[model samples]
Target chain A: MDNNTFHHALKIREDLCIGCSHCMNVCPTEAIRVKNGKSVLIAEKCIDCGECFRVCPVSAIIIDHDDFNRIFDYKYRVALIPSVFTGQFPDEISEKQIHSVMMELGFTHIYEVENGVEILVDAINKYAEQNPVQRPLISSFCPAVIRLIQVKFPSLVDNIIRVKPPLDISAGFIIREFAGSGIPAEEVGIFYVTPCAAKIAAIKDPVGESSSSISGVINMDFLFSKVLRQVKQKKSDTCAIPTSGELTARATCWSLTNGEASQLSGRCLAIDEIHNVIEFLEKIENEELNDIDYLELRACDESCAGGVLTTSNRFLTADRLRNRATNRDKAPVQKHPEGFRDISSEKQFLEDNISIDPIKPRSILMLDENMAEAMKKMDRVNRIMMLLPMVDCGICGAPSCQALAQDIVQNNAKIHQCIFIQKILEQKGEMSLEEGVSVMQDIWGFSKTNKYRDLKGI
Target chain B: MMHFEFPIEGGNFLKAGSASSQLKKILKQLNVDPRIIKRVVVAAYEAEVNVVAHAYRGIIMIDIDTSRICIQLVDEGPGIPDIGRAMQMGFSTASPEVREMGFGAGMGLPNIKSNSDELSITSEVGKGTTVKITNYLEQ
Candidate 1:
């Protein structure tokens, strides 16, 4: 009944989807509905968090991004590299070398999203100190988590820090550097080489902002091969690599869990992965985290390094990141005025508009669109639920006992669809399926003329 | 009107707050207002967690109508010795283990108090405790 205005970053190839309901069970938004043994995505409800993308056994979900050939559309292509990109490779290879590799891949300039993180972090620290409103101020870096708050935890929307993701800030930097210097914005294409599909969705249809400054998104999995090849091509070219001053390990470690929050001082709650994040959000909603100063919620296991698009194991990437940061000779951050000063002073954050249009409930329990009818069906469902054993074993095609109850009320299934109920009925052997259903209808006092009567035969 | 009841076992951290989650789900299915649902669920969760943390065994009864929701939690455990003092912030009687787990900062009753339209707690020191929380469906 609703049309989704936001761009969905992940698309499912319906032909490949097995309708196994794995994605449906795990979806935070309940965006996926399996009808007719095929997965159907309700676009309006989808946050494009890619939890479905990660869980799909058949890889039916594909992340939407610009093709590699799209880079040729602009005269000068600039790639915004996330800090997690550096941790994907060996610790010995510096981030500067990675920049050079991107240059080799025809990127004229490679700006670090970490630069944006540095500025954003400093700005957030200052903002928290200045405006002591609530207990735990939520971090807005992870687009998935932000949208999760919009969809599920609307009460905490005001708690989210009014800040843009690192990529948006980095794109702003690129626009300032090149656009004013007689370079048209169209001529300079700023692409994000991201480790997660959420970033792709963020660029296309950003939350809490009007339009993203970043031109396109290129998943890190796609660029890993090109970067790996370029790294091997000119292994000895040290001059092209930028200095350590430009690339600090502190900024680069944003890929790991709590990497950004560790830079900030105070009680910070960093939760990673969708399930863990959901759990923590429940606690936050419970007001159990009043003492916590900051809440960092990432939708990936080990943070962005464990993103669906990443090739390396998140644990390895995390270790590599720590080793790289510890071995660095320079200070954690440079004292240069250009980087921190611009970030801390100006504080480039978009206006907070996390209030997405209220989404309609994707209720699996609804038996009818009419309220009175739905309530009557709900009562019947509850009655049926009481009759069956509550084991949520999915042998009946429905996800759980509760789901089967809704199905029964909706006339999509019969009371005997539950294996436990079926087993009991089989053991009794006195009544046929139709008789059993009729008995149930009589016991529940449901009308014989109603839709539940149809399931009497089936 | 819809009524649901769920049992709660003390010290079962794993299953704590599940009843509240189920209640939230039911409210969503009924298409309750999002704001009202949040207020009711938060209050219910705090009451639910209190039972899990302090009570030996408890039963949560949720009664919903077109106009309001009433969550009544009755627990058989060590009842609060002093209800007046317990309402004060940061006065926690939780064990070291529960405190270490980042719970029992004595914010449970207060959280429920703030989120709900009406909250009443009645406890008998040696007997048990009963918490009744009610929230209107609309402002």
Candidate 2:
């Protein structure tokens, strides 16, 4: 019996697809069903996390995020730069160069996504040491993967590291740190210089509503090269970025080697590559392993530095980062920059991390039925799910065929979305064109008559 | 009470979650509270994926009763040798390839234990493994 879990609401554009199959390979849900040499996203099962958008080389997968021009609406613009940027350009290029370039790009000031990382690192370290019963604390940095776990791997949802992601942790800081000053938090716009589409999606549609201090996205791809040109002329500071530089080096740049997350012990389990993380997640989902005390997962295999937008060779940049980190002065900087390194406002940023309503997903009233009928329908749904392929292509506008089948089971959709149904009708060679058109009208809820004759496209 | 059995394909990672999906729909239509519904769904799905990824072949049987839901996954594959080791948090035998998909973080069994009202398992190295998990109705 086929009783596939489906991911709904993920889609792929056939017109735009290059058939690279990267989406097929990378899909954590395996919901993309390839038919007629193109991909379809089974809608029922897709988590709508947008992993496909990042890996698509031809820019085939699409999402609905706004452009960089949106920054103009804000009076005070601050950039929350992802640490992955340090690994993007050649290592010799100083952090000051990177920061100054962003400063040139309409951002009034910049804060390290690294500092947010420090907050997360400390939070996870403290939480893990204290709550020894929680097993391995799964890193919360990968939003797409985390969302997949929420919808598909609910049991593992609680297993997700409780600390806020570096991005959100930093956002919390941005709010109180800046707000503590005379500037109102609402008036100050925080923009994330993003490395991935997942982060952009996360900022817009947040997980756990941790109040992503980020207001909007300025994609690194659109702004990086322009920022680089500005950086080339900026002078390096020997003493200006000392404390920030020491902490922001190497391990801060990208996915650490094994035992990197738990620097306390090299024995900690480390896995990079988002796809790989999903596999481990499934293992955890299937009751295969749970003894791990720490699981360090990097969405990008080489870590965020391998982000598609970056310019430098990933290997070289990682190497240079390593060199710089090791060379860092063991001696403390004369003093942590008192002015910019603001902590007085941190008191306000320390807000409740726990969700007020953990059980809200079950609060919906629509999911109930009688015993006998429910069993019968369960059997029927399993039988119907088998005819569809397991690939989770978004072509059907569902994340996978299994998800489409879920919609069918829920009465939200029908089996006709499978594309094979139309093929079967064509294969039968028994119906007239008029009969087919009428069938389409009956099932598709549309007719030859225009719904809006005055519409511009029509 | 009638029992419905699904023949879960072994080593078929893609189709693993199907059984759980069917169970979830049934529970949902029965108007099960989203809380209880989720518990049953997660338990059933974890066992299903285990059958597909690790077993040679298996049958996922779902038995419904008044007070709780019971799922029995009986498999013919080489069963886990050290249940204790297998139950260890973050201990996974899934290959690097499997690791790529985020399925083998070794959190599955512990997570299942955490989600269910009761969990029991019996297995022999050469024979196979059967896991019985029950989720109480009121939870």
Highest TM-score among the candidates is held by which one?
A: 1
lDDT of 1 by residue, B51-139 (tens): 99999999999988767889999999999999988988788999999988767988888878989899999999978999999988756
True contacts kept of each: 0.21, 0.37
| lDDT of each residue in A59-109, candidate 1, tens digit only | 999987899888889997877777678778876776666766776677766
True contacts kept of 1: 0.21
Please report, in order, the local distance difference test score of every candidate based on alpha carbons: 0.74, 0.62
C-alpha lDDT (0 to 100) for residue B93 of candidate 1 = 95
Q: Can you list the residue pairs that collide in candidate 1?
A: none
Q: Report the C-alpha lDDT of model 2 over A280-378, residue by residue, as the tens digit.
A: 865654444546777767666566655544566666756766665665545333433622464323533453442212311221112225555555655
User: Model 2 compared with the native: what TM-score?
Assistant: 0.66
**Candidate 1: what lDDT?**
0.74
